[model samples]
Target: MPMLDAIKRHLWSIALFGIASNVLVLAPTIYLLQVYDRVLPSRSLETLSMLMMFMGIALSMMLAVDLVRHRLLSDLGRQLADRLDRLALAARIDTHARRLSRPELATAQDVAALRAFLSGSGVTAFLDMPWLVVYLGLMFLFHWSLGLIAIVSALLLVGLTLLNDRLTENSVRAYTTRQRETDQMAAQISRNAEIVTVLGMNAAMIDAWSARRCVDLDAQVKAGETSSLNRSIGKALRQVIQAVMMGAGAWLVINQFATGGVMLATTILLGKALAPVEQMLGSWKQFTEVRQAWTRLDALYRSSPERRAVELPRPTGRLTVEALAFSSYSATGPRGRMLLKGIQFVLNPGQLLVIVGASASGKSTLLRLLAGLWEPQAGTVRLDGADIAQWPREALGRFLGYVPQDVELFAGTVAANIARDPNPAAADTGAIVRAAQRAYVHETILGLPNGYETEIGESGETLSGGQRQAIALARALYGDPRLVLLDEPNANLDADGERLLNSALLQLKRDCVTVVVVTHRQSVLSIADRVMLMRNGQVDCFGTREQVEAWVKSRARPAAAPQSGEQRREAAAS
Candidate 1:
């Protein structure tokens, strides 16, 4: 009942309606039984027929009430699920800047499970439990001894329910681990379907994956059985106690120690009393599942306020990083090794800083910090002298355009991709086309069967890597961000694509945009205002192309290499 407060309004009405309907069904049956005992003692055929007809009518009413109640509960369940999903979505968006750790991702799984529980099990069974409560209470009123016995049996069943909860929690954790492995296998197969088939390892890979899955599934089945057994034990105990109580009650009446009508009523009430216990025991599994789900959803809903804290202020001007440092805890790296340390960088109007280094030199990490995707552990990234942390996420995003090495495009038309710019009016069609033209992708798109209106397949699969890169660049340019961080723009491009990239770089400089490119491509040398060389998470060298290389070769050999004017001429030639 953690988030029960949030959903109490919906729960109250659903539970009340369900309990009322269930009580009404029992009411008519109870009334008919009383009339039969009182009026049919003379044993008239017509009167007996009338009693039978009344019983039939009572049963019909019960069925109708059950149907209506079931439908309402189902609808309520769906609505609650929908509400929770919306809340989860909002929370995710609000925490978009949060780089989730493994534990955080595990918590996200709880949210997903909660959604499934609300839709499938939690709401319905929980709302219906009150009806069982009413049934049990009525039975208690008929005979105090029977009531005491049932109450004790229910307390024992509650213990079983708690045990079931423990078992279910373990199963859910194991299932989550299994699901991650399964998802990885599925993604691998999907990404390399053709390669697997060509290499003739498809069957072997599938066999391996299936073997792992089978092992996990077997463990899950065993845990399920254990849980079922626990519930069964509780149920069997309840049945045993029920039999003993009913037997004792009947024995006293048969021995002429009690009145027949009261005894008969007690017998009837005993069945009704057991009815609640039976239903409650039956619902214990679902109850445990939902309890865990509720716990998870509760945590998310509580953390939602923290996620919404990044939207208070707006940012202004180009981003600048000053003495930024970041460290990621890893098992393999040197102790206390910084991912980035004392990294001084500046991007003003019309300045292009090209960062060239080998992979794992913290290029992407630097871009992330500058883009406000993550807050720096030490030092500050500021826009116009104000810390980016003070800026609203949306406002900061508006001024910073970032395209990572792996470009992910949504499934949409070309126009949609370009207009994904938060403010499309600022990104006119002419502007989008010019950006694409500079990236050398405009004519190719115009020649497509449907031009800009054509649908791109999943993740823009219909487009080549170079084409996707060009489209992404177009999107970045559409935003007109003063600071543009491009991680390997020429990564998967042909000669023409590289030439287009060079042209785009020249235009960015001309437009007075602060552009930072992270690349290892030698061809990108011509567009660099200054090259910063990084090694071991520190800026080892910073200067013109020859100055940096001469320093590198000097470190390699004994004497310093000669700095010639010819190298400078060559730099200008490119």
Candidate 2:
């Protein structure tokens, strides 16, 4: 349905071209009739020459019209792809944020499939299908018997097409699903090649991948077998139909109901009428694929939220979280595990808040909420007295910087990675240099073979873990964002990296930027003006450094050793 909506404007042009092309097709049959019935009996050179000229002119016009038609379809395909690409990408991002099943790859592949079908011969066959009726009507005028044969042949081919669709539908759907899963698995394995190799787990990974591939392969083979069978049957049926049309025409001529030229022309017309059907049958697989692609893409577009129509002002550095809660679900039921519960906190401009907690204590979840990467189930994260969700995503991104525990860098030059630039050539060189300098990795980058131009392998594999973390930190610091959230920012940093990180934080504090750091390291805690201790999805303690430290000590102190009887008596006397 969406596909039709996209190309409706161009449909009229395609239809006109089909009409002109089919009309010109009549020139050949007419020429054959004239040659057999009139020219031969009259022996008129003028008539033959004139007919030849007309035939040539008609065919040349047909060629030109058909060419234009194909070009229009190709343009339509381009238009569809351009319109859907951004929408599809945005939908994928939204789905990921919601922690839903990812269908990005499948969506992209579906768009490509539809585009290919639109620009291929399959579309041309579809456009010409309407001409079958015109051809059949002309055949009926030749003789009743010939017309009857043509009608029956068309009906049989149509029946075969419907049968093929019925037989292959389920298999095709299964094959497509399995193929997407296999592709995702292969990609995961490729990205983790180093780990698999070092752990000697290649065999195991391959076996796992092969299991999925085998299921995909089985579905493909079954679908292919059925499709091939239909193709074979369709081909045999066409040949038989052509033979019967010829034999029937001969019979009509023997009965003096039709002339030899009429017989020949009727047979040719019958073939022309069946051509579209045969072509469609041959390309049924592609047709089915396109249909499936359209359905999926339509659903994706429908599910995505519309973009913000109005812009909001930029946010200041004050950050607040009120009663934030989050949970996830599964098929059986809700996971019944709350990652964050009743989270309430506030940090003013130019202040630092450090959150300390053991693993699975909801520390990272709070940071993610503050960054607006995940939405709260029952509360709001506000910046400068306005809900973060109220601001446009792009506008919010300008003032928000976040670094997760796991750092990933794109495949590009060091400068591009540091700048977070989607287009490297257009990136701000000065901004990149400043960020790199602030992170204290500028000199290290210069020491490399190509200063800022060195290419980092995928996910920055070419660099050490510390180098990646430093660059990622520099990326977060880019533009001097108003609010910065870091999860274990010093996790991989060595002594020098840690020193640079501290310097950066102090500078941010001086610049009046709000910062939230989640760490277990005491060195990081020492700089915090305020600290919160998280345990079991709730804040256990929240106060200034001294107050929180005192509480932590009180909690950590073991109960005094059981007093001996003499010690207890001395204490009571005192």
Clashing pairs in 1: 313-392, 350-512
Regions more than 4 Å wrong, model 2: 1-3, 93-98, 103-105, 303-306, 329-336, 557-574
Residue 56 displacement in candidate 1 (angstroms)? 10
Q: What is the C-alpha lDDT profile of model 2 across 1-574, one tens digit per residue?
A: 3556656789888888878888887888899999998999999999999999998999899899889988888898898887678777777667656556655334677888888988987888888888888888888888777878888999999999889989988889878877887887898899889989999999999999999898889988888889889989999999999888888878888988888899889877887888888888888888888887777777665554546756766666988888888766432334668888899988999899999989999998888778777777789999998888787777787788788898989998898888778576787788888888877888889987888899887999889988988888889888768998899989998888788888888888998989999998888777888899999889999999999989999999999799899999999999
Cα error of candidate 1 at position 565, Å: 36
lDDT values for all models: 0.69, 0.84
Per candidate, the number of residue pairs that clash is 2, 0
**In model 2, which range of ten residues has the least summed lDDT?**
327-336
